[model samples]
Target: NLLHEPVTIASVLSVPTVKENLEYVIHSSASDRLKIDGIGFIGARKVHLYFDPPLVKEVAYEDMSAYPLTENQIILRRRHGYTWRELLGPLKVIGVDTGAGAVKVNGEDGVVVAQVMANINVALSTANTQLANNNKSHSAPAPGASVPAGVGGAGSDFLNDLAEKKKTV
Candidate 1:
């Protein structure tokens, strides 16, 4: 399954703007990849999302038709990173190295329901978890630090949370 393979950053792209020119280049690249590998690169497409009452708006509007979400997104001139936490879902996949000319079955096999072999890394979730844990530990007070009697002080709560996380981790 996908969980079996080591996750790594597969590729990176720099887009100065979400204008039509950039979108055209992205589409052309996907088409080229499809022609060469017989596998479509759906992750290469980009969408321009425009909304009215642009800031602090309750609703959003899209100018494009329904389409699959991109692997990632970048704002025109804002932060360089784009992450989607709500769309996150666990995956189970297995990769076959066709170069070996032999197959190894780890488990049951059936007709493929859906598959995508884009240039993407699956480690984003794990990496994010590690980072969050690190931040929590760094902010936590020492284990033996004194805590107030009446209320659960931040130190005790932090240590308790840390211990719980350690057990789960």
Candidate 2:
């Protein structure tokens, strides 16, 4: 069964806006071939798939069919009529391989995901450090320090209530 090991499908898309894009990793064991005609989010209307990479096949939403060819491979078909430049990024030579002197196209989803996660981790760490510093800087006042009037002083009503509750406990 394919359940014994899971396969990964990685892809990259160039959209008009990054806010509309969703990043996800799905795990499924169903053998039935499934097709995705559109993708939508809650409160957002579904958008038609305009173009897919590599195969660039044009298929109607009604007739589109997709299934995993192997454990790791699935065919990609584009929505009809979208320009190649709109689906993929602008056709510019990004790099040249000096060793083989050949051009190669590779998907960057894995690298993009890794970089995003690293950025999130760094942000979380920075926020936690700032919170800890704030907490340390605003510690309780010294025993003889003057607490303002109506504040929680030694004879404050709040402290008296707590003392009364502690006696009953």
Candidate 3:
């Protein structure tokens, strides 16, 4: 039950050999974790660009057939949504130290490891929390409570059901 919308943005690569650009991008899935490199442009929205980056070998699950794969090889499924910046605004970048510059490690010289970009969209930011604005209108059902197709009830109903079920067991 996830929805994905198309988006775009500008991004730079960590690699010195590559050039960066602004391009249209499509966002999908639950977690919204996508390979910045796998994205492409859509239309006049050239300003909408995908952030591509190099990949390193890490264990991950490649498919559903292997449910609950090892951590190193696990690819957790994600809900689709737009990145935070797309929904909110340009995110401020921070500085980071990777110990060695691109040149020092790859033979170039004097490079810095910039802060990792975090997609803090409206759906992800703390601002969207259920406790934030008190979103009681679309509140989720409690555990063990069978909610009718479109019925509303107090949250206690769910907990009551769970208590009854526990007693029977």
TM-score for each model:
0.16, 0.17, 0.19
CA error at residue 3 for candidate 2, angstroms: 43
| Residue-pair clashes per candidate | 3, 1, 27
Candidate 1: count of backbone clashes, pairs at least 3 residues apart or interchain: 3
- Which residues of candidate 3, in runs, are more than 4 Å off? 1-29, 34-93, 96-153, 162-169
Q: Which digits, one per residue and each the tens of the lDDT, describe model 1 over residues 1-169? A: 7587788765443321211111121111111111011112234443432211121112221223223324233222211122211132211112222222222223333112112222133345445644876733233334544334444543456556655566565
In candidate 1, where is summed lDDT lowest over 10 consecutive residues?
A: 28-37
Model 3 TM-score, 2 decimals: 0.19
Per-residue CA lDDT of model 3 for 1-169, tens digit only, reads 2448655555432322211213423222223332221111111111111121221122211222132212212122223333323332222212111112222221333222122243345336434544554764333334444556335555445445544576566
Error of 2 at 138 (Å): 16
Q: Give per-residue CA lDDT, model 2, range 103-127, as digits (tens).
A: 2222222111000122244446557
Pairwise TM-score winner, candidates 1 and 3: 3
lDDT of 3 at 38: 15
Rate residue 31 of model 1 by lDDT. 16
The reply for model 1, stretches above 4 Å from the true place, is 1-7, 20-60, 66-169
In candidate 2, position 140 carries an lDDT of 32
Against the true structure, whose TM-score is highest?
3
Clashes counted in candidate 2 amount to: 1
